[model samples]
Target: MLDKQVCRNIKMVLLDVDGVMTDGSIFINKDGEFCKSFNVKDGLAIELLRSHNILVGVISGKASAALDTRCKHLGFDEIITGCKNKLPALVDICSKYNISPSQIAFLGDDVLDIPIFEKVGLGIAPVDAHCLAIANSDWVSTLKGGEGMVREFVDLLLINKLDLPLKDIYKPLLDKIRYDDVAIMEQ
Candidate 1:
């Protein structure tokens, strides 16, 4: 069973970009343009959750045009970057969304994210997250960042919040293949 408190209180999901979204890799070109790799599964999960009326946002300490472009493409409800003090940003997000601190869920993987984590209802940390962050989280994913960690969190939320049938969501994709096809695909 999911936490009843979490299911009841969560109204918004906020994320930190570097560690939470991209495994904390800052790929800088010689020209100083930075890029990051995001997991496709995580992106799809966000789309599905947003479609179900849950608002999502990102609050990152570092600003990047790549992040802006990605968030725009993904249709994130809000994106507040270059946030040195995350608590104020959280406060602003809560005020703008007409939500309370208890109605927010935040995902983070570093020390800088702890303030926001402490203020939100559902604080999430990835498997390989900083030790302090993991200790602070209400929940921790089994997967690491830039893997399927976010998707795992999304699955839990879907199961509890929407009571969505897990089988119904993925059965078609699974049923399309034979056992031999699965073996072949694994190869």
Candidate 2:
């Protein structure tokens, strides 16, 4: 269960990359390039959050081109990588956004994320997250990372915090398609 007050206070969402977004898997090709998989549903969820005026950002200890491409595609408000210590990154995000710590919700999945859990208004962990991370989190998702967990969390925020109905959450997106003459299928 999520604390409605805490959820309502969230103005920004921060995410960890490896575990929270990519199932904690890192694929290195022969050329020393890294590859990662992201859930399309999570992407849609992020788009919805952004549409509703909630800022989103990413923080990771590792840096890779794949991560950069994904963040760019999502149009994240902040992207901080190669950060071994995420506390400073949090501070930077707060300062940059001019949002208080109590207005931030972070979803992370490792021991490294515990310190952040303590500071943020809402700390969320995926079902497969580290035990300590789960213990510290304000809420735990039913799904694992890279498996629509982000979508699940977003739905909760939309419905419980923002008072948007689940079915109506797609109105903004659907309206665009309906009004823009975008073809969904070719005859």
Q: Give per-residue lDDT, candidate 2, residue 49.
A: 89
Question: Superposing every Cα of model 2 onto the true structure, what RMSD results?
Answer: 2.2
- State which candidate has the highest lDDT: 2
Question: What's the lDDT for all of these models?
Answer: 0.83, 0.90
Per-residue lDDT over 1-187 for candidate 1, one digit per residue giving the tens place of the 0 to 100 score: 3586576668888888888888888888999999889999889777766756789999989999889988889899999999989998888888888999888889999888888888888889999999999888888898888897888887787677755587654444355445659889899
lDDT over C-alpha atoms for residue 91 of model 2 = 95
Q: Return the top candidate by TM-score.
A: 2
lDDT of 1 at 43: 90
Over 4 Å off in model 2, which ranges?
182-187
Model 2 scores worst on lDDT over the 10 consecutive residues at 178-187
Model 2 pairs in collision: none
Instruction: Provide the global lDDT of candidate 1 against the true structure.
Output: 0.83
